[model samples]
Each structure stands twice: as C-alpha cells, then as structure tokens.
Target: MYKLFVAGALAAGALAAQLTQVSNYNNSAKAKPGMQDITFRRPWWVYVPDAVKSDALVVAIHSCQSSAQKYFQNSKIPWKQGSDRKGYVSVWPSSTTECWDVSSRASLSHDGGGDSNAIANMIKYAVGQYKIDPKKVYVTGGSSGGMMSNVMAATYPELISAVSLYSGVPAGCFVSASGASAAWNNSCSGGQSTATAQKWGDVVRNMYPGYNGTRPKMQFWHGSVDSTLSPNNYQEEVKQWTNVFEVSQTPTESKKDTPEKNYRTDDYGPNVEAIWAVGVGHSVPSHLDASEAWFGL
Candidate 1:
C-alpha cells in the first residue's frame, strides 16, 4: 500500500516536478503500540544553479479537498524547473486527511493540528538531511491549503521568513457560507463588509498582533473573478498587512503576456507585496510563474 501510494505520488511529480512522498512509522514509543503510520506527499524540486547548495527553501501547502499531486500539477509551469539551471528544494505535504481541520467540523478536526507540526518537522529533517539555508525558508498555498499556510505562518512565525497565498482565507478563519457550518470564529468578523475582506483583517490582526512593530515579508494573490473564496478578501489581506508593516500603498498595473492575463501589485512595505489578478478563477494562475519568477527556480 505504501509503495503504491509513493509510486502514484512520484508519477504525479514527473508531470509537474513539484511533488514527492515518503512513508514512515510513528516511532514515538510513548504512544500506542500500533498506530497507523503516515504516508505524506511533499514538493521535492530544488531550484539551484549547478551543484551549488540552495540558499532558500519553499514549503507549499495544497488546497482543501485537493491532493499534493493536483496542486503541484496545476501550479505555474516554470517552477517545476530550476533557476539559472540551479534549483531550490520545494516541499509540499499532504494533509492528515482529504480535508484540513481548519474548522470545528468533526470530520476535519483530527490530527491535533499536526499539519503545521509535520511541516516544521520536515524542515528540520531537510536542514539535517540536505544543504538548506535556514534563514530563507518560505511557505505558500491555495484555497484551504492557503488557509493552512496562513495558520502555519502565524503559529510558527519563527520558522518562516515569508508567505504567499492564493484564493485563501486567513488562519483560524471560518465562515458560514451557503453550505458550510459555522464552527470556528470567522477571521473576517471585525473587518470590512465583504466576507473575504473581514476574514483577511481578522487573520492579520489575530496572527500578527504586533504588526505595527515588526512583521515578516508577505505577499498575497487572489483572482477578482474567484467566487469560491472571494477576491475581495485579498484586498482586506493587503490592507491589514500594509497597516501592520507601516508601508505606503501604491497600486501598479502590469500585463502578463500569457494565460494569466492582466494583474496589479500593491507595494506595502519595503519588501511586502500583494497582487490581484484581474480575471482568474479560484485556481492558481499559470501567469504568475511562481516556480520560475517568484522563487527564481
């Protein structure tokens, strides 16, 4: 079973070069005698130049109800290849289950929020097992996975240097949409009128309480046409981050000569950036070119 799972995951990676999987038993002797072992998938591509060691690592989280294979296969294409003929390692781990435990739903709230811990452990392992630069670690995700990325950044600020999210809500954010139950507090409660905006405000405030003082470099992207998660939420996220980082907002428009279409960037702080894609759906845009342009791999 484990071998099959690994083989399937690797096959998916071959298509996008953004995924890998490993199986390991829970060796904590203090636990039960025979708990089910874990088989997790993660991004394994390292964008490096030649044989030189990487100066940074990117840990990507996938969307809810989505597997690592699907997310990796759908991301910007250039990321699958490395930068300047070099590559930096990118990691993506499957959630404990098919859906992340972002809400209080009985079916989602299992694994004791080990998703973030699992990521931290993976980084630790990578540092010891591979040549990785500790100061340059970054995280990103989309949709539900995007929410998890936010949670990880908030919960483990010391472990991450920067974060980027797509069509996602903030950490610990829950909403009572048409078909969803309202279990966890909505991250958008104390913000703008739109659900997306409110959630963004709440997430930034809750996660970066000392934002007025100091915060990490951050970036966010959302499609204006995305109704599943709402593009307005990205605006609120940018507003909160800019306020926290004490940066001026200057909207700059640019056109990508690709399927991603036109987009704009808001420069918040010296290093903070937020983008709104004009016509994209809930999916990650192939135009942003994360693998090649953003991370330079």
Candidate 2:
C-alpha cells in the first residue's frame, strides 16, 4: 500500500504532544463496566494540540481493534502532522471495546444525549473546555470508525461541520451486530438494493425529525481493491449522502486527481465528494491530502 505523506508537514517537530486523561464527561458519573454512566466510558483520552485555537477541533475516531491515541498517532494522514502550529485541537475517545456501536439502531442514541454518547459528549466537552469553532468541527475515521464518522455527521449535523471517511460502509447497513457479523462474513454482499439504500438515507433524515436545516458536508475516500467490504458499499455511502445533501444522483463534476496514482473525484456539490483510487486496497488513499483539501484545513 502506498501511503500519502505531505512534504513540509509536522510543524510541531520534537514538540511533545500533550494528552490529557479524561475519565468523565457531561458532569456525569464515571463509566462502570456494566453501568450506563456517560462520562469517560472506558477511559478515553484527549489531545489538545499546543497553541490550539479556542474554536477549532477535530474528533478523530479509530477503527475496530485500534485504540484512540494509537490510531491517531498511526494515521496515514495524521491530523496533527502539522495541525498544531495551526492551532487545531483533536479528541480521541476510545470505544469501550475498540469497536463502536455504529452498525445498529441502538447506535443512534450514542450522540449528545447521555453519558454513553461517545461522539456527542466529546464534542460537548470541547465546547465546554475550549472555545471550539462551531462551524469548523470535523469528524474522520477509518473502517468501522469511518462508518461512525458518517453516523455522527448525520446524527448531529447541526454540530458537525463536515465528515470524512475511508473504507467504510454507509450508515445503517445493518441494525444490529448480528446483521453486521453476517454481512461481514459474507463480504458485505449485495444488501444495497435501491430500497435498502433509500431506507438507510432515511436513517439519517430521521435523526432530526421534521428537520429542514442544512446538512453537513460529506467526503468519502475508498480504495478500489478493498476486499473486506463489497465495493458496492461505496455507492451505499454515496447514495445515502447525496440523498441527505439533496444533490442529484449523478455527480455534478468529475476530475482526475493524479495521473500517476489513478485517483479521481466525483463532486456532487461544493460539500459532497467521492474519491476512488485505483489499485488501492482497504486503507487510506495515497492522496488523502485531497480529502483534507476539501476539508479546507
């Protein structure tokens, strides 16, 4: 796999990153193994870049089996590469078991409402601890974490400014772990019927009943040769998000990324984009900086 690393990155070279240990949130009680306390469930970690802007924050979620700090540290396109000099604050909350509840109906409730709400409460914590810019908050992740990135944007469109994902299925591919297990075992085969896709789009809509607000911007980066999930999953995401953003099914624009790397982008609107990199597998594209460009970071 070809990894993408931008030149002149790491503005914070040799500057030790500060990671604060957070055990609770929302003024809620600490999380118990079986209890439903919302704050600090499973001992999450937070990293506020030195000289971070009061109002800019990015919540980076990790894939299943990866811890928050480790995933953030190892990301191909680490948000903190040079983001600290730009004053970007980042939060990495560990999922209780290194896996989020994104593959189910129950996952909908995991935002801002209770102590167990990982994404929402984390954002809330940012708003409380720092002067985070409401219009600049972002969420990005890989694999299952990527799925939750889409989920958080859909569920909390009002709070999240934009979302980016790599190698993830669309939201609502399955409503339970059993279904996810079955789908994963079967290579996520063919569940994306038109109806299935539309229903999944509704899962996003229902997040805000009777909502007539602006939908958050979306970006997707998928490897063309990914074998873990069906390639159809890409369209599953494109279909769901284009519907949410109210853009036409056909992209409004298309362009090649780099002639040498076989990268391309289908732009639906100023805020919606889908990227496909040829010869890449289930990992971040070598040109993920393109996604960051769209993020306007």
Per-candidate local distance difference test? 0.54, 0.67
The lowest-lDDT stretch of 10 consecutive residues in candidate 2 is 179-188
Best by TM-score: 2
Angstrom error at residue 175, model 2: 1.8
Model 1 residue runs over 4 Å out of place are: 1-20, 24-53, 75-78, 83-85, 104-113, 175-214, 248-261, 286-297
CA error at residue 281 for candidate 1, angstroms: 1.6
Relative to the true structure, candidate 1 reaches a TM of: 0.66
* Candidate achieving the largest lDDT: 2
Which lDDT tens digits does candidate 2 get at residues 17-94?
A: 676777656645233344334333445677777676546677777887887777767847467664565667777767
How high is each candidate's TM-score?
0.66, 0.81
For model 2, what is the C-alpha lDDT against the true structure? 0.67
lDDT of 1: 0.54
